[model samples]
Target: MGRGPETAQLSKYFYEGNDISDLPVNLSVVWNGNFIIDNPQNIQAHLYKCSALRESCGLCLKADPRFECGWCVSEKRCSLRQHCPSHESSWMHTSSGNSRCADPKIIKVG
Candidate 1:
């Protein structure tokens, strides 16, 4: 589902047991099952954000010390090296315990 301000507002009402309709356009299409957001697979995919969950360089690098996490220097976000859309020059990973992100970059990938 699109995580805009509307989704935030709708989620609040949804989780509170309020009957909801006309979900956010993106969410509405897939939310044809139950009153609550009950699709297990979709919910898991939505909640399990891996790299994106790590908001900053420190948190991103802290995920697995370069094993599963890498920082995208140009984008300024935690991402997986293999899956990162940015250039290879922008990827930073752990080089020994010196694990750091391009000077300040952390070594966490998705």
Candidate 2:
């Protein structure tokens, strides 16, 4: 049996042409063309990242937005504002004003 008229376009979206990255990962049944990832945990697990573990100033500053972490330019460490260098000026996140990391290298994208 074929998909009814209501779901035909959605079926075409998945089967005919769809970016694999755009597929819903949380759903147990994800479809893109003939390939499918059921219960996508492997890729989901990769999503969790600790901001403190980021090695470089740029890496820490450019980290995932979900986790709140800042780069201490002087200390050369990545941590939350409370844990960074014990000085508010040294800690630099995207929103911090008067941050020590005013150099051209530490550009924060809007």
Q: Which structure among the candidates has the greatest TM-score?
A: 2
Candidate 2, 1-110: lDDT as tens digits: 88634322333223223222123234334345455656545544222333434767666777665566678766777777777666566778866664445444645678
Q: RMSD to native for every prediction?
A: 13.3, 13.5
Q: How do the predictions measure up, each by TM-score?
A: 0.38, 0.41
lDDT of 1 by residue, 10-108 (tens): 343322222321133223333324345545445321212335447676666666442456667777776667666664777666643444644455466
Q: What is the lDDT of residue 55 in candidate 2?
A: 66
Number of the top-ranking candidate, with lDDT as the measure: 2
**Candidate 1: regions farther than 4 A off:** 1-48, 65-67, 95-110
Q: List the global CA lDDT of all models.
A: 0.51, 0.55
